[model samples]
Target: MSKVKLFSYWRSSCSYRVRIALNLKAIPHEYVTINLVKDGGEQKKDHFLKINPFGFIPSLEVNGDNNQKSIIFESLAIIDYLENINPEPSLYPKDLIDRANAIAITESINSGIQPLQNLFVLAEIENLGGNKDQWAKQLITKKFKSLENIMTKTAGKYCIGDTITIADVFLVPQVYNAYRYGVDMSQYPTIERVNKLLEEHEAFKAAHPSVQPDAPKQ
Candidate 1:
């Protein structure tokens, strides 16, 4: 069995996605918390940058059977790796078109919505005297509106169908962020419904930010 270590921040949507994937695949891993805000963000520090040059959370370090070490960054790439290694209870659809639709949903959130409102981007907005909350709310609301339309057509019980796909993995965290940013989820009933069902799922519950080791005590 490969030894896996995950360097993650509790509240990062990217990290959250990977956590759900790991739990869903029942992959054993050591969780190392990287406080993104403490001491000016641990992810930007030299030691962590060595693991992931991009200074991103959810860096996966894998020591293979032959004792070769490999590091993977980026939530989508890490999840893809997990899916490749553990094929059962797959996080993607079996049908070709369904799979494509699932991937499309993942990309929509990964590239289209997430990047615009990440910590660094929001901090930069504040640096320029912009209201970070308002910026995030507007962007999330707009993208979520589009996602709701897509979900209306594709969803059955989860994001892409009754089976939970990579789309659900990506969707849950973004919806959490939407709630945090006050996006008024009622406008996106399909999204809200899917999110509600996912939140009750064991894998999703285990991966939720509030339950993470690094989350603030309440």
Candidate 2:
């Protein structure tokens, strides 16, 4: 097994998703905190930029073969790499169609929803003299409405049937963002239920933002 190190911020939804994937796969890793909001965002610093040119959280550093290091940025790419290397207890379905469905659901959150309401995007909205909260409310509500309908069909004990897949990894973190932005989850019963169910899982619980090592001392 290679050494794994995760560069993450405690409250980043992307970071949270990767954390759950690592814990769910029982991959041993070291957590290196990158305080996203501290010192005008540590992620923008040269040190972290060297690791991720995009200066994003949740960059996974893998060390193998004479301790040669390879870094993967972007949440889905990191999760895919992890799944490829650690195939036991797979997070993706073996069937081709089911795998596509899983990736579809994952992308709906990872790309369709997250980018519009990302911290950087929100900041840009504010700078443009737009109301950030209202923007988030509108975008998240619209996207989650689509997600809820998708989940209604795909979910069974977990997203895309009874087995936990990459879809669930993406789901839980976005749900956290939903509540944070005060999106009315009451309308999305299936999504709400799945998020609640996944939260109870040991791995998901361990990866929650509040419990992270770098979480605010509250």
Candidate 3:
């Protein structure tokens, strides 16, 4: 491989998922910080749009011989790509059934809960003349309560059976967004507990938004 590069937006939850996975796999990759919030997302530019027609952040570029390449968009896909590169110390279980279940777990809430509360979705909700803050808080609380129920079935030191699977990576960022919008985490003690433990892990620590170069001049 020539080099690995990840184009990312720090505050984006999807980017956070890829960051955690790359760190866990001990991959060396340069971070290209894209400005997601500045002037309607530089990601939408024609240059970048070609990279990902969807024009979303968190695109992973795997450079290899002859400029031959692989590109992965979507946080979960990038994580799976990282796993394929370094399978030792596997984040995924070997049993096919176990792996299937694991993928199911991550996809469940990642699709279920996150979309309804995204930045763009939230803005749309606000534009509809509803109380955005109140609606966000309400929906988040309900979704988390649902998540708490599902998580209790298989949470240990992590979200799924003691391993720091992709689910955990997905969970932490979602909760972080919850807190950002003033949702009281007190209602979800289990989620809070997991995040506290995960935050100390090297991957999560390195991936934290505060540590990102583009996070605000301080």
Model 3 worst lDDT window (10 residues): 93-102
After best superposition, candidate 1 residue 88: deviation in angstroms? 1.3
Could you give candidate 1's per-residue lDDT for residues 1-218 as a string of tens digits?
Answer: 67589999989999999999999999999999999999999989998888878887889998765898888988988998898888878998889999999999999999999999999899999999999999999999999989999999999999887899999999999999999999999999999999999999999999999999989999
Q: Worst lDDT window (10 residues) for model 2?
A: 63-72
The RMSD (Cα, Å) of candidate 1 is 1.2
Which residue pairs collide, candidate 2? none
Q: Which ten residues in a row have the lowest lDDT in candidate 1?
A: 62-71
Show model 3 residue runs off by greater than 4 Å: 64-66, 95-101
- lDDT per residue (tens digit) for residues 1-218 in model 2: 86699999989999999999999999999999999888899989999888878886789989856888878989989988998899878999989988999999999998899999998899999999999999998899999888888888888989899999999999999999989999999989999888899999999999999999999889
**Candidate 3 lDDT by residue in tens digits, 65-159:** 57877677887778877877788557776667656766766776688777877778888988998787777778878888877776777678887
> Backbone collision count in every prediction?
0, 0, 0
lDDT over C-alpha atoms for residue 171 of model 3: 81
